[model samples]
Target: MAHIMITGGSSGIGLQIARLLVQRGERVSLLARDPAKLEAAKHALQSQYPDSRPVHIQAVDVTDGAALHAAVMDCVASQGAIDTLIASAGMIVPGSFLDQTAGDFNSQIDTNLIGVANAIRAVYPSMIAAGRGTITIISSGAALLGIPGYTAYCASKYGLRGLATALRLEAKPKGVSVCICFPPDTDTPQFRQEIAQRGPETKRFLGPPKPWPVETVAKHIVKGMDAGKGEIFFGFDMMMLDKLGPIIRPILEKAYERRNKKHIGAQEGR
Candidate 1:
């Protein structure tokens, strides 16, 4: 049986991935903060697989390095080394440049960027020792296309993309594959909450409609992880943006200006 460790497996895309992996008979270990939610997710998985491989939960914040390392070590020891590690823990707190605080940006960088780094640091040595493993980092469409009001979210996700690129180069000789995923607007609670935060004018600034069910994105990610892909940009407009990166930037910038104009008008009316 393949042993897999997934951070943020308690909910959303991570939870979906965990459920699918467990259904496929993989030994799944969850690293998440909420014990109750984690237990609930585990129960849901167990309901589907009564004879499923072990589903262990390590309830701890991904931002906590020492604790994260301990949790990884414990999982690795128990599972006889993880065959795969998915750094899927992430969040979004959207705001325009003027409305956001230093804390807002820092918190995202700490969780979205440093969180991935910490998990990789904790998992890589064991994977290297085993001489085989795959690491999947969950980025976002914002990493490729800049959204009008989501400066911090885009920056942190871009950092994840960069980290994945570098790690790919580093792990090549060790037979370890690193995969970076760029998923579009997922129908997760976080996306719904961010859209709800939008003012009338800025709501349009969210850019394009959300598409693809959460399960579809999760399946695509699993396929990429299994194939040892360097990076997988999933979803509709996101793939186009990545393909058109050279010409897409200037076009997106102009579009964002128009979107900002609407926001400015809304603010003036207020």
Candidate 2:
């Protein structure tokens, strides 16, 4: 059985992954921001994995490098060595570029980019020492295709994709594998909130109305981690986009801008 530490394990895809891992008899520890959410997640998962050890929860904001480092160490200490690390915590604040505050941009960078780097730095030593471990970074399809009003979110996830690619090269020699995923429109509370905040006027610009269940995404992630795959682009359309992203990115960006013209103009006029 492998010990896994998942950041953002309080809910959404992270929580789903934790529950699935526990059911498979793997030891799971969660690093999250809310004590109450962590405790509730622990209770909910523990009831499902009755034979497993009490689910470990460390309340640490991923943006805090010191706290994140300490939390990773604490989880590693309890679990012996981390067999897998999933950088699954991320946030999205949807709006036109003009509507985006400096804080909004910074928060996405801090959480989605720097946060992943921090977690890797914290656990990499032990993973390298062991000469065997896997990392699954929960990236998004937005990282591949630029979307209207999701500039900050896309930039942060694109940064994660770059980081994961670099880490894969560095960790290969150490026998550690990295699996980065491009999960498309997962039906989590986060996605719901993003849709609601985008409002009816701007929603059409998002294009396509399918948001997949978190459980399906979580299952693909676990399987990819097990296989040590380099990348997993969840869903058929996302796979196609992954293949064409490099060539079509520019055209796609122009199309997205055209779709959001009214919203962008409105935001700029505010």
Candidate 3:
């Protein structure tokens, strides 16, 4: 059993992954901003996997580099070396580019992009010194295409792709494997929050969000990690896009524009 640490593991896909890993006899550590949620998560995991190793929980905002580094060190000290580090912490604020404030954009960047980088940096030295480790980054389908209302989210996730690609090149030679997972709209607390603030054009274009369950997403991610795959695509459509994103982007953009125009026309008629 490996020692695994996951950021944002207090809930959603991150929590599910932690639970699954613990069930498989792995020692797991969870890091998030909320102490209450982290305690609750630990209780839930302990109840479900009574025979498993104790779950290590750390309350640290991913955006705070110093706090995050300290939290990571604590986990390593408690659980021994981290064999797997999953940088799953992220945030999203969707709106038209003009409507979204600069603060909103920067917040997403700090959490979704830079936060991941910081988490990686904290664990990287240990992994490199050990000469073996697995790093999984949770990018989104938004990384593939810039949707109508997810401009900032798209930018951050796209930046994650770049980070993973470059890191993979450097780490692969050193026995550290980097995997980036592109999960589509996932059924989580975060998704519910996004739904509450979704723009009409985005809602129409994406069509009544059918998010995949946390269990399903976690299953695929763990399987991919086991196989040591570099890129993990959750859905069939996502896989297709990963392969042909540039080729099909123009077509997708035209379709979205047509849909937006129709939605506007209907709104105007009303």
Candidate 4:
């Protein structure tokens, strides 16, 4: 069985991914900031797959590099060498760029981008020595465009895309495959939180929140990873965005601007 370690594995997409892997009889190690959540996730997985290898849980904030590294090491010690590392830990703050503070940008960068780097750095040596491993990065649709309220979120996810591109070049020669998944809005706690903070312009441009189920996304991601795909784009919208993002950007921007104008006018009238 493959030993897999996932950051942010206590909840949402991460937890769902763990559930799938455990069902497949793969050993899973979950790293997250909340100890209670971690334990709860472990229990849920164990209850589902009682005969599978014990689920490992480590409580550590992804933003804390040292703590993350130590937790990763402990996970490795308990689970043996990590055959796959899924960097799913991420955060987002939705608002106009002017309304968002420097701290908002920094926090997203530190967790979404830098946190992935730290987790990779911690487990890279082991994977390198083994001369084979898979690294799955969970990016978002925001990485494709500069959404008004998701300015900081866009920056962080865009940074992840660049990181994945460069890291793949280095990892391939070492027999490591890096897979990046660009999932559309997923129905998760994080998405709910993002919606609560979205600006009027963002809300208008985005329209209704039609999110894919976390299980569906996890299933696609795991399948793509197993296929050794370089990039995994879910849904027609995401596939189109991946291929035609640059070509259609101007049109999208204009459309969003028009929506923003109407939204701003409505707010003023109210």
Against the true structure, what is every candidate's RMSD? 2.1, 3.1, 1.1, 1.4
lDDT preference between candidates 2 and 3, better one: 3
Report how far off residue 173 is in candidate 4 (Å): 0.7
Worst 10 residues of 4 by lDDT: 197-206
Give the true-structure RMSD of model 2. 3.1
TM-score of each: 0.92, 0.91, 0.97, 0.96
What would the TM-score be for candidate 3 when compared with the true structure?
0.97
The residue-by-residue lDDT of candidate 4 on 48-111, one tens digit each, is: 8899889999999888888888998899899899999999999888877788898987899899
**How do all the candidates rank in terms of lDDT, highest first?**
3, 4, 2, 1
**Top candidate (TM-score):** 3
Candidate 2: where is the Cα deviation over 4 Å?
199-202, 250-270
Give a tens-digit lDDT track for model 3, residues 1-270: 799999999999999999889999999999999999999999999998899999999999999999999999999899999999999999989898999999998999999999999999999988999999999999999999888889899999999999999999999999899999999889999999989999887887788888999899999999999998999997678888888988888888888889878878988999
Report model 2's TM-score to 2 decimal places: 0.91
TM-score winner between 3 and 4, please give it: 3
lDDT of 4 at 148: 79
Ten contiguous residues minimizing lDDT sum, candidate 1: 199-208
